[model samples]
Target: MTRVAVVQSCTGIDPAANADALTAALGRAADGGAAIAFTPEMTGLLDRDRARAAACIVGEDEDRVLATAREVAARHGLWVQIGSLALRAEDGARSVNRGFLIDGAGAIRARYDKLHLFDVDLPGGESWRESSSYLAGERAVVAETPAGRLGMTICYDLRFPDLYRALSDAGATILAVPAAFTVPTGEAHWHVLLRARAIEAGAWVIAAAQSGRHADGRTTYGRSLVVDPWGEVVLDMGEGEGVGFAEIDAARIDEVRARVPALRHRRPIPRVEIAA
Candidate 1:
């Protein structure tokens, strides 16, 4: 069994302060004997104001939060997933919401940019145009680590099942879905969606989340979760800022798949001709 830690934090507008908070959380996870640590989306900073967020964003090489995470991973000898950092894009008009998978040696093993953008206008008059300031990624990423092969995704990607299916087909046993989900949608759909993904893919799903009200006055749902392949929630950090730990057993994936075999039984649907 590989032990993993998931961090739930209320990130503010300040990148430096966010890094400090994440570093401290990593320390706690390390003390708990976790082999890998996962952080929430926008781990560096969370600001709704596009201009202010752009001003605060920096290149990956200059991001203090990313640097701190690397250092912490190396110090603890733990694999770290820096869940999504908003970095200044090469185009200059927008930023990239990128996730990094780092080895215990502090070397970056894989990078996955967020493919889906949240562009919803909510019922409470809250509006988000994430695509306006963030470019969408074109590819999916799966990386090999000590614990298992992990498929990386962020935030809005959770709503897309095809992505998860593709990852599972590509040999990913675990899926990392780090999110900064809005409270309203999260309350209604978060748990069900995550559990559905795990059950459909026959994979372990770990979701570290952002919680509470942030500096930009945005509120997020705070249930960081670890769901087993059987659709059971092994761990749930409910409505608070803290760290949660869970064990990932590779055999559990096989056990679940052997019983159902849904993946192997999948067949393409035939197109039907209708009278016009």
Candidate 2:
């Protein structure tokens, strides 16, 4: 069994303050004997004002949050998966929502850009045009981690089950979902989708989420959770902002897969044709 920590935070506009929040959470996770720590999306900065956020959003090389996480990971000898950081794209066009997997030695093992951008207009006039500011990634990414092989996805990506299926086919034993989910959607679909993905893949699903009121005056549904391969809820952090620990049993994967080999049973379906 691998011990992992999920960090729930209400990030602010200032990178420095966000860094402090992450640092404190990481320290707590390390002290509690977590081999790896997972944090919510936009862990560094969560300012809604695009103009104000632009000042803090820089390329990955110059990102303060990335630097801070690397330093902390090295100092504590703990692997850290930063959910997602809003970064200035190299092309100088739209930014990218990127996630980083850092080893215990502070080396970046893999990076995944968010494949799905949130471009939705909700019922309450809460509209988001993520594509206007962020470019979506083209590929699925999976990498080795302390818990198991991790498949990375940001908030909106959770709505697409095919991504998880692809990841499972690619041999991912664990799925990492880092999110800054709104209260309504999180309340309605967050838990259900996570559990479904876990069961479908016969893998572990660990989600770290942002919660409570933020500096930018946005409220997030904070219920950072860990679901096992059997679709069992292992841990739910509720709306509390702190480090929560969960035990990941790698054997659960084998046991679950052995019982119901859904991944192996997958079959590609032909394109749908509508009746004339």
Candidate 3:
């Protein structure tokens, strides 16, 4: 059994505080015998103001959060997957929502930049244009780990099943979606979307999420979860700052795929036109 842990918590403008909270969470996970741990999106900072984000930017080589997380992972001898950090982009005008995977020895294994942007108008008069402050990533990433191949993605990417399918086809048996999904969307679509992805790909889904309200007054849906290939939610923590853990049998992945085989039966979707 591969024991995995997820953090369901809040974030703020203070990067140091966030790191401290994460370290404590990691300790809890380690005590529970988790071999792998993941945190929520914007694990470092959560300022909605674009200028503040730019001002707080740290280069990939010298990022404080990354450095601290590496040390923590090394100390615990566990695989650590940070949800997302605001790293300087190529143009230096904005940052990329990047997720970093660190091996048990604390070496950086892989990184994935978030591909989708969250641009929406909420029912409560909240408007977010994440693209304004982030550059969309063009590539999908899947990395090999001791447990299995992990497909990495950020918040908004959860809405796109195509990306998840591509990762599944590329031999990904586990998918990680680190998100700070807004309250409205999270309450309505979070579980459905996560379970659907797990069922469709016949892979385990581990989603770490931001819960409660942030310093910028942005509310996030906080039910971080781990779902089995059969769409069974192994663990779920609704609305709080806490750690959730589950032991996943990697061998069960093959059993589910062999039993259902939905991935092999997918027919190519055809385009259609309608008269105006």
TM-score per candidate, chains pooled: 0.97, 0.98, 0.95
- Show model 1 residue runs off by greater than 4 Å: 269-276
Off by over 4 Å in 2: none
Q: Comparing 2 and 3 by TM-score, which wins?
A: 2
Each model's lDDT comes to: 0.94, 0.94, 0.89
Candidate 3 Cα deviation (angstroms), residue 105 = 1.1
The TM-score that candidate 2 achieves is 0.98
Q: For residues 159-243, could you state the per-residue lDDT of candidate 3 as single tens digits?
A: 9999998999898999999999888898899999999999999999999999998887788889999999999998989998999
Error of 3 at 252 (Å): 1.9
lDDT for position 84 in model 3: 91
Predictions: Cα RMSD each: 1.1, 0.9, 1.6
Clashes of 2: 0
Query: Candidate 2: lDDT of 101?
Result: 98
Error of 3 at 73 (Å): 0.8
The residue-by-residue lDDT of candidate 1 on 119-220, one tens digit each, is 999998989998888899999999998779999999899999999998998999999999999988999999999999999999999999999988999899
- Model 2, residue 187: displacement in angstroms? 1.2
For model 2, residues 171-230, the per-residue Cα lDDT tens digits are 999999999999889989999999999999999999999999998988999999999999
Global local distance difference test of model 2: 0.94
TM-score of 1: 0.97
Whichever of 2 and 3 has more lDDT, that candidate is: 2
Candidate 2 positional error at 58, Å: 0.7
